[model samples]
Target: MAPHPPQSRPSTGPDPSAIDTSRRPFVLIWEVTQACDLACDHCRADAHPARHPDELTTSEGKHLLDQAREFGPGQLVVLSGGDPLTRPDLVELIEYGTSRGLRMTLTPSGTSSLTPETVHRLSDAGVTRLAVSLDGATPDTHDTFRGESGSFEQTVRAARAARDAGLPVQINTTVCAQTVDELPALRDLVDELGAVLWSVFFLVPIGRGRVLEPITPDRAETVMQWLSEVSDDAPFGVKTTEAPFYRRVAIQHRRDANETPTDDDIGRRLGITAGDGFAFVSHTGELYPSGFLPESAGTVRDGGLVERYRESELFQSLRDRDALRGKCGACEFRHVCGGSRSRAYAHTGDPLASDPLCAYVPDGYSGPLPEGRVSGD
Candidate 1:
């Protein structure tokens, strides 16, 4: 099927460029399952091949959907998993969530289950968009990284099928030391697949992800610079995940090039950072600041997700940029670029610690180093 004309960029809420901080956290990522066929090297959930007996049932899923509605309308509930498609009741769950006034999206590990018929069913079930991961530009590299031969082919086929089914498609690519060099080719593939958005997720060491080495701070800065330059001409909108500091880098680049930055630019800077504007619910119903952070705030079984989000000290502390440690706490762009809490926690065992992969030294930071500095002493 020929790619459908690109639709206006899809967002869970109002244009992020004009986001209201008072009404933050308009997105909830729900891990619907912990079972997937592939054993990706960077799988954050450490998924198994069999569904956990304690996974949420369809009734519990419906209750969760009802609770999610309390976050307000236009809120995006991203149903993700080891592979959400692994669940037979996925379509039923999607329909249930959407029927309750929540906009839904899906993030499925690309596998045989993502056939054209499955894509059509998902579309019919009210999924606004589908995000599929593509880590490498070539099959050999991607397949090996996924720990499943033929995964690359399946992913490409799924992307095509999703578009053919008239479902908006977003391609998520992980950027690490290994895949950094292949981004240009991956960008080409994204364009070829006619994806509407390309999300670049910088590696955060956690679960199975701890085994893969992340790129150095200097290399990360260089890659962001490259992304900032090429994004202007790319066919799809570009965003970064687990790398909120890219906003500061992008704004600085624009200013260096003599462009006047606007409040919209700054407001748009508030991407899905942990606790501030994002929430994660595990398959077992445990609530977290983010899927990456894995710090439990509460569980859906206790009920009142909105209350738990508001009352959790962890969430509150995360939202308070002044509580951040090291360079991040002292950075002039603290509000706009709070750095990655997950990466900080992974490297220094402190979620409030400065992200080690960010090379930008804050403007007025001359204080003595924090006790467990992940960067240079």
Candidate 2:
């Protein structure tokens, strides 16, 4: 095997030309607040309801909206939080982003205290998609992970409300050892909900999620296999069987049909661009390169939106020649993997660790498996 890519420090200073306006912009999951009503066991953000008052002020949030708009069309603007609906200013943020031609999604704990009027307001605010976390098919498993007794009921109710409002609902499930066995049942529930998509997030063992429960490699593999099966058969517009493993299936699907997804498709399909890709805007108004990790660039408050694009370390690193090469060059799965830096950091405490979840079968480990050949033999 090729030697592992050399470890190098990320460049600290920003370069003005670093912002790749030439390439379509990334999807921005602007985390409006970290104050969430539910304390899910697997949440990497360590969100809680009491923290909202201390997060981004109303002015800071508006600046973030402006920065997101600079990315232009085909970008997604996801308003997330401990629960976005908890923010009184959510409508303004959503409206501001949508006015800039951004497609948007609102991620709530489903305990957003969203009345029917508020739900319709979100749709009017340009939230075309809605994603609610449903870790298990039933309350026993789900509520346990969410750390709330009635979370399942709340999430289900919110999803139904979103659907009834004509917004496409996607169930976001975080697969862990505790919930792995019930994946099939979860998929069945998605179908019953009439939801349009399912995004399965493998437990990354970060923050409170790690403190609660973690998945074994074997369980991760099991979840990946389950997701692939569901993706093949699922009717959702965006169906990723695996968490980070979505790339492989997406590549084949995009190839076999000879369909080329535009920037919007790329962002939403890969969870990268605006409303779709993995993203997180911090309470300080700094953008983590992605939502799954808590790393940051400078605060949007200290600088204009352009300053973030030009100077933020995360953006700079993502665009750096040496950095992207280090990640993109090694591994047989490069073309399909497109490793997410934030996930890498959250899982291994290093932005560059080989993803632990990537299946690594020994060359001669084949036993009773199909064709009597090992995965890497």
Candidate 3:
């Protein structure tokens, strides 16, 4: 087999411009199962306790891996789920994808199943990286957010075990009204865990997450600005999940310090919007531009993923930065920070609408602004 692509970040980010996103996604997320042990408040999947009877079979999973490889070698495939560990054939699937020249990553629920043996098994199976969520620094807050009594401990243990097993660990944190207060402490925890990356996921109200609170645009602005400061010295790389304005904030921060971004910087921090550089495949085979953006392009059961992603109207609309509406459409950083399509759809029915969470409003644009305008303040 071809050696796996060398990766500097857990996300395996390559130069975004070199890759033709119209034909292939930078990252493909496959929800292997919806069956999970934890009931996370912000769970996009609204995961089930038992596996769906119609969940893709092991053979079907191999076929999907084959389809993923069609994107080209070194395609990043993240095996996400309610908890990937629930799937007994997860390792087999990872091995198969790795053999097909896909850079395989896994996001498993932190539970009793995340033992050292399980981590070692995943490492031995050619899994490129392991991402575990740690929303809060303390057990009380994190466990409460997860709706489990011991999930915090399990998450910490699993991250440590993954590190000991020679697996690069990435910590996924939720940023919202409920958990945002703990971010500073969680940053310390991320450093303590020796994580390679800290993926701060700004919450999008979906499913169980609908009941949870999203931070206001001003609050998000403050947080992203602070995170920009944190990234300056944090050992691990930092990326926001649903908030692309962090890129805008970072760029502005650097420029304010009279630092001009190099050519490498231009490609490394691309804002991968829904249906742009990212794609998601549900457990039932439906292909979405993003898990948070439920607008399905088609199902694998009906058509090939390549056709849906490349030629579908929805994907096409999302990829066109010019098609974006309101402030996002006029923003100078539109291409580099296209805004979060998922959050845009959640706030406005139009997937091409501007992300309300971003406080930046481009100058000289007279269109109606987002609800909370930190406009020129």
Instruction: Please provide, for model 2 over 215-268, each residue's C-alpha lDDT reduced to its tens digit, 9 standing for 90 to 100.
Output: 655556555555655666777744442244455445444454234433222234
Locate the minimum summed-lDDT window of 10 residues in model 3: 257-266
**Which whole-number lDDT from 0 to 100 does residue 19 have in model 2?**
31
Model 3 per-residue lDDT at 229: 86
lDDT of 2: 0.61
Best by lDDT: 3
Model 3 alpha-carbon drift over 4 Å, by segment: 1-17, 256-269, 374-376
Measured over all alpha carbons after superposition, the RMSD of each candidate to the real structure, in angstroms, is 4.1, 11.0, 3.7
Residue-level lDDT of model 3, residues 26-136, one tens digit each, is: 889999999998899999999978999999999988988888887876889999998988898987788888777788999999788888878877887888899999998
Q: Tell me the whole-model lDDT of each prediction, alpha carbons only.
A: 0.82, 0.61, 0.86
Worst 10 residues of 2 by lDDT: 7-16
Write one digit per residue (lDDT tens) for candidate 1, span 82-186. Answer: 899889999888887877778889999878877887787788778899999999999998998899988899889989988987788999999887888899999
**Model 2 TM-score (2 dp):** 0.77
Error of 2 at 43 (Å): 2.0
Error of 3 at 198 (Å): 0.4
Scored against the true structure, residue 27 in model 1 reaches a CA lDDT of 73
TM-score of candidate 3 versus the correct structure, residues matched by position: 0.93
* Number of the candidate with higher TM-score, 1 or 3: 3
